[model samples]
Structures are given as C-alpha cells and as structure tokens.
Target: MESEPTAELIRAQLRRLRLAANLTQEDFGKQVHFSGSQISAIELGQRPFDRLFLKRADEVLNSDGLLLGLLRIAELHRQPHFLRPWLDAERVAQQLRCYHPTLVPGLLQTEHYARAVIRSDDLLADDEVERRVAVRMDRQAILTRPDNPPILIAVIEEATLRRVDESFRGIMTQQISHLLDCVQRGGVLILVIPAEVSVHVGHAGPFTLACGADGDWVGHLENHLGGATIDRAEELATLHARWDGIRSVALPKGQSELLMKEVMESWSTI
Candidate 1:
C-alpha cells in the first residue's frame, strides 16, 4: 500500500529517474514532445502532476508504472530543506524580477555549471554537493510551469556572462546553449548590462523580486553563506525600483541573445 502522491514526492522521483538515466532536461523533453521548461516545471512541482504528464514521464524514463504508482502514494518524505521562506515565495510567485551582478541566477544554471559552482567552496562532502545542486536545479521549475509561470525578468552583468570557470570547455558550452534555448523559448526575459556602463545602482548587490498571485511581493537576496526573504512592502518597492534602474542599463533581448551566441561559439574554440 502506497501513500497518496504529493507534488514534492512526484518531483523527487521524476528528478531521480532523469538523473539516473543521464538525460538533460532538453533531451528528455524531446522524447515526450514537451519543451525543456515544461519538463522542468513538472520536475520542480511548479506544474501539476497530471496523468498525461505521468504517462509521458513513465514512457520517457522507461519507468513502466513506477511513476504513476508513486503518484498514488498518500504521504511522501521530505527533501533537504534550506531557504524555506524564499522557496515558499517562489513556489507561488506570479512575477519575478531580478538583477544579478556576480553570476548567473540559480534558476538559469545548467547542471554542469551548477555543479561547478556548488563544488567551488571545496568544503562540502560528495553527497552534500549533489544535494545542493539538485535542490538548486529543482528551484528553476518556477520558470517552466505549463500554466501561470511567474514572469521572469532578469538583468545580468556583462562581466557575469564573460566570467569563465574551470568547466569552460564542456560545461560552459552547455550552459550557454541552454541559455540560448531558454531565451528562444520565451518563458523568461534576460537582459545583459554591458561592461561599458560605468556605474549603476546594481553595484550594491544581487536582488530578486517575487510577486505572488494575490499581488503580494517579496525581495530576495542570496549569497555564499545563505539566503533570506523580505516581505516588507517598502523594502520590496525599493528593490523593484533598483531592478528597473538595472534593466534600463541592460541590453535588449535581441542583443543579449546575440552576445550569448557569440560566447557559445567561442566555447567551441576553447
């Protein structure tokens, strides 16, 4: 006798099977006639775990009836918990506005890129590294839900795009390619702040604004140590204003994707 399936449980099993099969979300999505974003939404529990999705996931993973069976469970166990408030806000956010000056936001990171970032500190054990990476990847689902995905408008620094890491040859290629695909897919808007811009309010730090369905909004900040959520309307309003300033300095989507393509092509030569 299995417990009823909750969103979390279904997402976990889906992620596990996908990882075990060594398939990227894009590749997995192709097999099921779904976009990578849609697959991501299902895996992150941002989208509903409908039977149609279960049927496709079952076919794609070669899981037979395992996924559907898991969906029938009553209660599932929890995954490692961190950033409870922020994660909660993201889960129901109707709109997302962000400015990242240092690195690509977690929601847009490729698995390889994410793995590199996760292991950079060199403090976590192997298991811990895997867990953190998985959690971060799961958070990206907010951008891919089949219905009512939060409108994501992110402005990243030009330097952040050019910053090369150890995985330049393989991971960078994948990361840029994934970014390109996301941009072309149209669920999110990504802007790049050119290096030529001398000064901007974004110089302070990275921040994200998540607006919930009920019109409530929150500001989010995350760093190497940890992350927190801000619910004060005044504070969130200020963050929103800052984000507007950053976006004003950022390149338009067409130019940004063109820059991304140049970088993606450069990775091949490296």
Candidate 2:
C-alpha cells in the first residue's frame, strides 16, 4: 500500500500537540508567525509548513517529537504540488459556503457530467482526464465520511441549470437528481441565483468558505489559470458577508428543488 500522505502525518502530530496544550488556533497563531487561518490550513494538511513556521510551531506548541522528519516528508513528497494546502483545508472544514457561477462544483458532479466537462477541456489527454476525475472523486471522501461531514451550502447561477446540449443534458439531469438525494440526506444546501439579481457577489468565479473544526473560516478561490487558498481574516470576513447576500438573493431551497425538477423536465424535452 502507498505510504500515508506526508502532510497528513504531520497534521496528526500537530493536532495532538495543540489539543494537549488546549490552545485555540488563534492562540496558537499568536505564538507562531502564522494567521489563524494559516494555522488551520496546516492542521488540515492543505498547506505545508516551512522550516521557520515549523520551528516556531514546535517551540510554541512545545512539541518534543521529530519535527525535522515531518518537514522532510512534506518537502519531498507533495504532489498536485501547489494545491496540497487547499486540499488539506477542505478535509477538516466543518462547513462549506460555496458558489458556482457557471458549472457544478466537482464534489457535486455526477460521473457523466464530470466526463463531459473534462472532454471539453483544451489539452487534456484521456488518461489525464481519468486521473483528475479519480482524484476529484477521492477528494469527495472528506465531506462524506461518517464522523463529521462538512455542510455544503452552494449558490449556483441560473445559467448552470441550463442544458447546453442533449448529451450533456442527460448527465446534468442525473447530477440534479444526485443533488436532490444529498438534500434528502441533509448534508447539502442548494440555491439558485435568479437570472435577474441586479447585483451579484460571485461574478468573479466559483469559490467557497471552509470552516475548520476550530471554528475558523478560510476563504477559498482557485485563481485564474490556477487555484489559490486565502486565509486572511479581512478577506474571509468580506467573503462571508458577500455569501450572506448571495444566500439571501438565491431561491429558497424548496423552490430551488422544484426548479431543479422543472429543469430536468425541460432537459427531456430538448
């Protein structure tokens, strides 16, 4: 079997020390040089700790274990290599506030819909597409585990509800069906932003807010042509306020579910 992801092993140790010391992330951040969001990211395995950060954390958390060993592993083995930090954050995020302006989030996609989206990409080979899809499916495990599944609150634009082509439409319909199932299980919140919302907050692109178990929220955006994770409080607070407004303007869940049904019906007609 493959060795455990290096980031995960380090997180396990840091978490043990933090809990032992009874330090909240904010408390810990003050002792270290990181922000609370960055500390949370470290604990979540989304971001690797550089030597300076690790040394500070080791001193602050009063860890006696092998910090260097852990750091070496993280330094050498990280892949998706730029996104480990974001992925780490998602695992421990207890709540998710997300928006998709043009497409469904990967975690919410059906296999067929995911494939169609991949097939349309500019330069991906079939093997690469399959590998990426597999990775996405694996990533969904965090929000699906039995212990503490993350609450997903998503606001999707009305445009995403449209069926662009029949082949993709059937897949999307199934995806809507899956969403309805998730709603039934009480793990998801789906909202549709009206076509005529005069002002919208997520015109930029898809993004999310991830709340760590320590009750800190990390703002998320994958940058243009790449993804970046943001943990600054100033930015997170602004994003939180924007999310509240988006939630307010979006259709109510009941109506949204009904509308989804209607869209699926329309898809059959096309």
Candidate 3:
C-alpha cells in the first residue's frame, strides 16, 4: 500500500511542533532551514526536504525528533528528483523564461518531435522513454489552463531550427506552427539567437525561470546529471541578468517569427 499521504504526515507533525513550541512559520523555518516561505510550503503540503536537509534541520530547528520524517512516505513519488521543483514552480508561475541551445524545450515540443529526441538516447529503455515522454506531455497542458497559464519566453539557438529537415520534419513544422499560434494568441514570446551573434552569458547550457504569482522567482539549470533549482535572491538576480543579456543578442520577435515561417515553408523540400 502507498504510505499515508506525504503531505498530511508532514503537515501534522510540523503543525504540532510549531504549536507546542509557540513558533511562527517564519520562526519555524529559521529554526529548521531557510525562510518562512519554505516552512509555509512544507506546512501547506507544497514541498518536501531532502535527507541531508535533516542534518541541517536538526542543527537549525533544535528538534531531534527527525530531520525529514516525511521522506519515507514521499520518496515513492520522486522521479529524477531534479524535476520535482520544476513541477512545483511551473504549476504556480505567472510567467516562464526558457533558453534552449540544441533541441526545443520540453514545454513546447510536439509528441513526434519529443519522441524522436528521446529515442536518440540509446541508454533509455522503451518503458523509461515512455515515462519521460508522458511526464513532458503532462506539463504541456499548463499552456492552455484557464488561470495562470504562464507567458513563455523562449530564446532558441538558430542551429536548432536547422533540424527542421531531420527525420521528423512534419513534427518540426507543427512545432513551429504551434509557436506561431502561441505568438498570435499573445501567450508566448519567441526569439531566435542567430549563429552570428557570438557573445552570450548562457553559452554553456540551458536554464529557466518560473516567476510566481506572489512575485517570487526561481531559476532552473539543466545538466546531464540532472538540474538545479535556485531560489536564492542573489543567484536568481544573476540568472535574470544573464537572460537579459541573451535577449539582447537574439533577433526581435517579429523577425524571428518571419524567419521561422520562411524555414517552415522550406520544409516542403525535405
């Protein structure tokens, strides 16, 4: 059987601790880890901490009861661990910023294009590929949600568009067409980083930012090992600065759309 709900187990335990000790959520997070927002996330069943976080929690909160008693119940639901924070932020963000270097970002990929991209990784078993693809498709619904459907800003490298003539040309065309629709609908902002523009701060890899309704922002950096979610103010500011630099180096939206439309038309030759 699945363990009792992870959120409930954690919230109950944390509430009792705070109440019995007469601590505010702000005080509790300061005692336990980082900030009031973090404690609020824990108490509201919106977040969970890692194992080593226990050691820090113990040291910070002065509670020997256990660092993360909820992990046993929550670990079963974990996948890639790296993506958990992305889901949490994505579901709440008012706007999203993504910079892609090679392939399209997952949020905007069509099923066929996504499948082809995944299949390129020979290490992924058939089942694992399906699971990953399903996870991505599940995220796509956020684009059309009635409330807080995020405004997406995507800055993609021009070289990536060259793959439009690859095996899954139709899918690439559809993805480009989808972008056109999104732009016309005012739901997305697309920019193309031309190969000629040689200078960029994010040249090493891809990153994203999820701006929350409360005005809080978080940054995500993806790597072969997994990904990184940054909530620290200074770090987030640095990421924002870098993204601004990238945008300045990219083509204006109208020009980029025209470029994409022209190339998509060229796909007929493939």
Candidate 4:
C-alpha cells in the first residue's frame, strides 16, 4: 500500500528547500507570486496549501515534481478517514454508479457548488472546509484522465437540480451548466429521478457502487455522521437491488439533459 505524507512533512520540506536555496520567505514568495506571509503560513502549518501552490513551489525550488507528488498523496490524508478506502476503489474502478437524493453527486459538482456544500457545516473551520473542497475537486480528475477513464453513471433527484441557494447567487446556474458540459463530453451518463415520483428506494440514502475490471465490486454508503465501504456479499446485493430500483424511475439521458437545461434557465432568471 502507498503511504500518505502528513501536512507537517510537506511543511518541513518546503522550509528546508527554501532555506537550502538561501532565499528568505519573502524572496521565495516573490518568485512564486505569493506574499511572504502566505509562505510563512504554509510553512508554519497555519494554512493548508492547494495543488496550484504546491506546483508553483516545486517549480520555484527546482524540486523536480517532489512537492507536486506529495500533493497527490496528501489528498488521501485530507479526506475523512472513513471514506479513504472507497476513494482508493474509486480511483481504480472501471465503472462508477452513484445515486444522490438531495444534492448533486460529488464527482460532478463544480468548485463553487462544492465549496458551498463543505461550508454548510458551520462547525468546520475555514481551512478545513477548503482542504475538503480541494480533495473533492481533485477526485474529479479520474473522469477525464488520459488513461482509460472510468465510465460514470450518476442518478440525481430532480430537486437537486431545481433547488438553488439564493445566498450563492449563480451557483446553481453554473453547476447545471457544468453538468450539461459533462454530458456533451462523452464517457459519462447522468439521469434524473423526477420529483413527481413521490416515493422510491433511494430515499433510504445516497450510495455508490463501483465495478472493477476484474469483475469485483465495492460499495459505499454515506450518512450525516460519516461513510462506510461495503464489500460484503449480502450488503453489496442489497445495494445493487436498490440501485436497479432507483435507476428504473430516473429519466433517460435525453430527457435528463432537457430537464437540466430547463432548470438552468430557471436558475439564470434567479
């Protein structure tokens, strides 16, 4: 198994490299187009660094992809512990089937929408929220990875598309537009369970099922507290049955896209 590096490890390396280069934090920050205080915060572990920061830092320090490599590994550590196993499965799965009843699936969410979702937890600190959002965005890379990208099939409740948080101005419009673009891009299929269907098995909660190239399967279930990975045969069977039931009521791809466009227009008016 691959090991994950801690934030402290990354911070220490940054400081060591910057010092070895004989540059003050301010000087290094100038080269990276960031303020000295920002560099100080990162080195002191007072703030979390995003991928862009790590990339620029690596280039400036001539680490030859060292920091960038750490960034990828660090993403795993940033995710909630309960979700890591499923995340590993998601990275290697040949196909991913996801169902969400109240919100857009994380794999397909835009950055703005993701930020809102993370921030919805008022108890979380700003840095923690940003870190989680970064992980969510990075997970999306698998969808378009040059290598055999997984075929993603997502089913979302129609209310997810119609609901808009007025506080976030154009968030819904941007999110719906992104979904349409994903549909146009191929290798992805998104269907919607229309609101008219008052009852469904999906109401039990959101779950994801992944199929591996080797004919194995992994399941994931999420609730308010946390999430769990499912590999047990009986549990997998139940999830599979629920998935079929939910997919049965969802609109076909063509109808789904049309409904999404209609919602997008409605959001634009708001």
Candidate 5:
C-alpha cells in the first residue's frame, strides 16, 4: 500500500518545485492567482490548503498532478486516527440516528457553533480548533450531497437548545436557527427531548448509529478523551435500544420545531 502523504512532505515538495522552476513565491503566486503571503503560509504549513489551491499550485509549478494527488491522500489521513473509521462509515451511510444531551449533533452544527464548541476545550490552539471545525463542517456534506444523501434523525435534549455561551453572544440563537433551517431543507429530522422528562437513557452520553445501504449498522461513542467505533453485535444492539428509548420521549417533528423556535426567540432576548 502507498504511504499516506504528510503535511511536511507536501510543503517540502512545494518549496522544492518552486525553487527548481527558478520562480520566487511572488511570481509563483501570480500564476496560481494567490497572494505571495498566502503561498508563503501554505509552504510554511501555517495555512491549510484546500483542493482548489493544490490544483492551481500543481498547474503553476508544473508538478504533473503530484501536488493534487498528495492532497487527496493527505485528506484521507488528516482526521484523527480514532475517528477515521467512523467518518468513513458516515460518508456512505444511508441513514443516521444520533442522540445528544449536551450539544447539537455535529452533522447539523453551523460553522460558528462548531468553532465555539471546539474552542471550549481550551487546550487546543487556535489552528487546531479551526482544523477540527473544518473537519466537522466537512462531515455535514453527507446530508446535503446530491448523490443520495443520508436521512438524519437527530434527537437533542431541550437543554441543549437553551444553553447559552455568554462569551459568544447570540451563538445559541444562530445555532438553533440553523437547526430549524436544516429541517426545512429536508433530509433531516430534528426531534427535541423536552426537559420535563429529565431522566432518560440518552442522559448517559451521546452516540450515533450509521445505517449503511446494506442495512448493517455501525455505532460511535464519544467522550472527552476521544471516541470509539463500535461494530460488535452486542454493542450495536445496546445502542439501538438506547436510541429507541430516547426517541420515545422526544417530541415529534412538528412539536420539536415549535420548541426550537421558542428557544431561539428566548436566546434573541438575551
């Protein structure tokens, strides 16, 4: 098997190719339609380069698609090793069932909300936060993809909708509004487990089960340290039972939307 490309490897190749072509960063940037500083940041590994930038750079550097190829392999390995399996399953899932007691499901989170959530850790540097946020936003594509997007049934606790981050004013409102928008757009169903039913199985933690096209299900469980991909039959069965318990208490689609709107309005007042 071919080795996955590393960030350092890509950066080194870019610098070497530019030097070999006898072109300064400024000159190369001109050809690639990027600013010299932007190119500098990419070469220095200070900025994350997307596919478009890599393709343009490859063309300008005459790398014969080398850079683009590296980017494709690098992206597949960019996510944390622990998450790669679950991410792979998520992309091809036919349906997803998720339950969250503390925050919105990652698949439905807006960029701003995602950034705030990742930043809450306080241990990660700014760049790491941005990177994780980008990965999360990318994962959301499965819901909107034109080619058979997965149907998402997300059960979120009512408290999650009302939780406020005083530091980030109006973040909750924007997030809740985004959730409402997602439901309106189709392929997503947001169900709220009202606070009145304070005790429930979902209160144990958050988990997601991805149902593949063939009807096989894989489960993912998360915690502060990291997460685990669960495929064992007994574990999957437990997850399915928990999901049913959570869904049983959650408000139906219509009531959930109304509840979200009420919380959003309350947030607007704060």
Candidate 6:
C-alpha cells in the first residue's frame, strides 16, 4: 500500500518555488490562467491541485515536471478512503460502465443531489462535506475536457428516476435536465431498467466496471455494508456478466430520455 500524499508538503514546495522565481501569487495566477484568489486557495490547502495547475506551475517555475509528479502522487492519496483504488482506476480508464439500483451515480449527480448524498453521512463536518461535494463534481471532468473523453455508460433503475424529495424538487428537476443534456452529448449513454424486472444480477447491488486502454479491467462493488474494488480476473468476469444481465433489460436511450423528461416535468408542478 502506498502512503498517502501530503498536501502540506506540496504547498510548502509551491510556496518556495514561486518565491524563488520572484513571482507573486497574482503573477503566478496570470501565468496559469487562474485568478489570484484561486492560486491562494490552492497554496493554502483550501482547494485541491489539478493537473493543469501543476503543469502550468512546473513550466512557470522551471521545475521541469516536479509539480506534475507531485500531483500524480497526491491524486492517489486524496480520494475518500474507500474510493481510493476505484479512483486510481478511473483516472486511466478508457471506458466506464456503471449500474446503480437506487440513487444517481456520483459521476452524474447534480451539485445539490451530491450535497444531499454527502450530508447523509452525518459524521462529516460542514467543511468536509463541501470538500467532498467539490471532489465529486470535479470527477465529472473525465467525461469531457480531452479531445477523446472516455465512453461512459450508465444504467439506472426506474425507481431512482421516480424517486423525489419534495424539499429539493427544483434541484431534482435540474438534475434530470442535466442528465438529458449529458446523453445528447457524444461519449455518454444512459439506460433505465424498469421496476418490473423480477430477476437480475444487479439486484445484488450497484457496481461499476472500468476498462483501461491497455485492456485491464476492475470492478468496484458497493452496498450498505461497505465497498471494495475487485481486480481478480475471475471476479471481474462475474461482474461483467452481471452488468450484461441488467443492461439487457434496460430501456433504450430514446425511451430512457422520454421517462427522464416526464420526471423532469413532474418537478415543475411541485
């Protein structure tokens, strides 16, 4: 197991390098296409370091790839405890397949829905909650950005689509609308499994499978008890079969979008 990376160390290094280069935070921000405040937030450990920022810092500070190297190590250690390995796999995956029996997948969750989901973990402090929400939102970047984004296919249960919170009706509406927009964009696919499906492998729980460009595959299985990432070929094969079982019964993209529209419209009346 690799030791967790320390943000404080990176912060110290950034401060030293920037000063050595005689660049003020504002000057550095200008060079990196970030606002001074954003740069300050990163140096203060209030915001996470992104690859782009580190790349710019490396160039501006003449440190070769030191900042980027730090970021790579930092990325591995900063994930929420249980999600560490899955995140590592996600960073390099060429394809992502997610099947959720209830609730939205984190990658597709709207900001409000993410907050609601994170708040469910009562043990987290307010700042920690906000930090997690930011992390989840940031993870969505994988679906876009690069010229070739990963192929993202999600199969959500009918119950999840129909589920609503009266207090957050507006937010739910926004979420559904966002989902609709996502499917419209290339590289994303959304399917819905109806409530009537009597038997399916997904009935066991939600799981995500990530396939790397190099042909490696991993499965992250999650339920109420806990979660684990399975890399064993035999275990991944089982999960792959289960995904096929659930996906086979799921509604096509057209129908799923129609159902999603209905759900979005329902929120308008509330």
lDDT agreement with native, every candidate = 0.77, 0.76, 0.77, 0.88, 0.86, 0.83
> Candidate 5, residues 17-55: lDDT per residue as tens digits?
999999999999999888899889888877777666777
Highest TM-score: give the candidate number: 4
Tens digits of per-residue lDDT for model 2, 162-260: 846755767877888887887888888989886778567777667888888899887768655667788888888888887887788899999898888
Q: Which 10 successive residues of model 5 have the least lDDT summed?
A: 1-10
Give a tens-digit lDDT track for model 3, residues 75-189. 4364667778877898788999999788788888887778888888999998667656756676777888987598999998777876654666778788888778878987889
Per-residue lDDT of model 4, residues 46-149, tens digit only:
77777788889889899997877777686676567888889889999899999999989999999999999999999999877877787788899999999999
Model 4 is weakest, by summed lDDT over 10 consecutive residues, at: 1-10
Model 1 — TM-score against the truth?
0.70
Cα lDDT for residue 237, model 6?
A: 88
Q: Write candidate 6's Cα lDDT for 84-141 as tens digits.
A: 8888788778999998888889889999999998898989898668767766776788
In candidate 6, position 196 carries an lDDT of 82
Cα lDDT for residue 133, candidate 4: 85
Off by over 4 Å in 6: 1-5, 13-76, 80-82
Whole-structure CA lDDT of model 2: 0.76
Q: What does each candidate score in C-alpha RMSD?
A: 10.2, 14.2, 14.1, 3.6, 4.7, 5.5
Instruction: Give the alpha carbon lDDT tens digit for every residue of 1-270 in model 1.
Output: 122356667788888999999999999989888889988987776666555577788888999878765653321134314556777788799988887788788888998889888888778897667656766766787688888888888788777767775556677778778878887888788888888997999989888888888888888886666766788878888888887888888989899988888877876776
Q: Higher-lDDT candidate among 4 and 6?
A: 4
Model 2 misplacement above 4 A: 1-78
TM-score of each: 0.70, 0.69, 0.69, 0.86, 0.81, 0.76
lDDT winner between 2 and 6, please give it. Answer: 6
Arranged by lDDT with the best first, the candidates are 4, 5, 6, 1, 3, 2
